[model samples]
Target: MSTAASTEACSTSRRMSIGMLYVDLGIVTRPQLFEALVECARTRCTLPAALASLGYL
Candidate 1:
């Protein structure tokens, strides 16, 4: 498979694994979990200070 295809497959597997882990740990929904992840990720990016001012921090 191509690099992009492999990367996509890996991401899907990872999400499935994490979803199951969350279910086992009693997380209620994917939206809440992924939203938290996205927000957490935003904090670590370059120029995150701008986002912080925009209330993304």
Candidate 2:
């Protein structure tokens, strides 16, 4: 139960939780998630925003 182990365990749990939400709950569709990520990227891009603009981000 060390601090590092606890942090890693929590992260893993959170990842699973998000996966379940995507699959079972349908809180956010796969495409919508992808779009939001792309928008966030465009808002933060400098070297390359092509992925976002091209619908691949």
lDDT of 1 at 36: 42
Please give the RMSD to the true structure for each candidate, in Å. Answer: 7.4, 8.9
Which candidate has the highest TM-score of all? 1
Candidate 2 residue lDDT tens string, 1-57: 999889756754654455446546655556655554445444643212423354533
Scanning candidate 2 in windows of ten residues, the lowest lDDT window is 45-54
Candidate 1's C-alpha runs over 4 A off are: 29-57
**Which residue segments of model 2 deviate by more than 4 Å?**
25-57
Q: Alpha-carbon error at 4 in model 2, in Å?
A: 0.7
lDDT score of model 2?
Answer: 0.50
Question: Across residues 1-57, which tens digit of lDDT does each residue of candidate 1 receive?
Answer: 999889756755665576556656764355554554455345533223323444433
Clash count of each predicted structure: 0, 0
